[model samples]
Target: MSNVQDAIVNAKDKLPNVTPTPPGFHPEASVHELKSRLLWGEPGLSIIDVRDHDAYNQCRIRGAMNMPMDRLPGGAEFSLQKDRDIYVYGANSGDTSQAVQMLREAGFRRVAELKGGLEAWREIDGPLEGVDSMDDPGPDAYNVFARLQAFNEEKAKEKRMK
Candidate 1:
């Protein structure tokens, strides 16, 4: 058999369960967990910001949609599916929890409160978009390897500090 075929066979034997497993969907998720999902290019989940219009326009998790608290349930009902995995946040933990409760009451089964909101995401340097996040994406924006390396460094720094 070819060397490539042999390598594949060996690899399969060594790691029989190897597969793409995105971060777990839970009632609450950490910023790192969400970041890991984005880095792996998983798009099965949604991030919703429950903050008001101005707050959302200022900054938010890159792909997050703004669904302000007052109208959040109605907006989400109109736009999102009941079983969709959703990571929600707001101006604070209280708001985040409240949004999660609202979505659950609205019959959405898979909803999670993203603990620490935008501040936690920014602490780990997650990609963001909005007028307040207008700074250049830097020279390495498209360099996946460099971004991964930076992520690793941040993780290690976090570990060392703790």
Candidate 2:
């Protein structure tokens, strides 16, 4: 089967029996809500930040444990109970989706991604730490622009060659 078809089958098999959350369920909560939920003790909720260690150390929702996508196989050792809510986030949805897939494959029942990621959090003036200065552009925005530029440049180069 084609990779895309395989991916569709795999994704369908991985989704929990429970109804998935509608898109944009919590339109306002930032990364701060994620932190609060973890800190204030949602008995079964656990937060996983899928960003790399460097970015994680620079700043992340307090108490969020790093579970970078590349390292998620190790998460099986954590023995996460299938019953709990597993909240995953990255600099944005792209990374979050990958992590959610991993968690689902591992049989997590309730998984949710933080909407808009850290950028949305900051936009709404959400709480943050280890961010001594706000001079740095967000990684999510930068990555999107960089990818677009690369694609455009490649297309331009192809046109010139043609």
Provide the TM-score for each candidate, comma-separated: 0.76, 0.54
lDDT (tens digit, per residue) of candidate 2 on 34-149 = 53343233455666778888888787655567888888846733756765666777876878877777777777655677767767656644445555534443464347455344
CA lDDT, every model vs. true structure: 0.80, 0.58
lDDT of 1: 0.80
Those runs of model 1 whose alpha carbons end farther than 4 Å from true positions after fitting are 1-20, 138-162
What are the runs in model 2 whose C-alpha is more than 4 Å off?
A: 1-41, 76-79, 131-162
Worst 10 residues of 2 by lDDT: 20-29
Candidate 1 lDDT, tens digit per residue, 46-83?
A: 99999999999999999999999999799999999998
Q: Against the true structure, whose TM-score is highest?
A: 1
Q: How many backbone clashes does every candidate have?
A: 0, 0
> Could you tell me the lDDT of residue 111 within candidate 1?
89
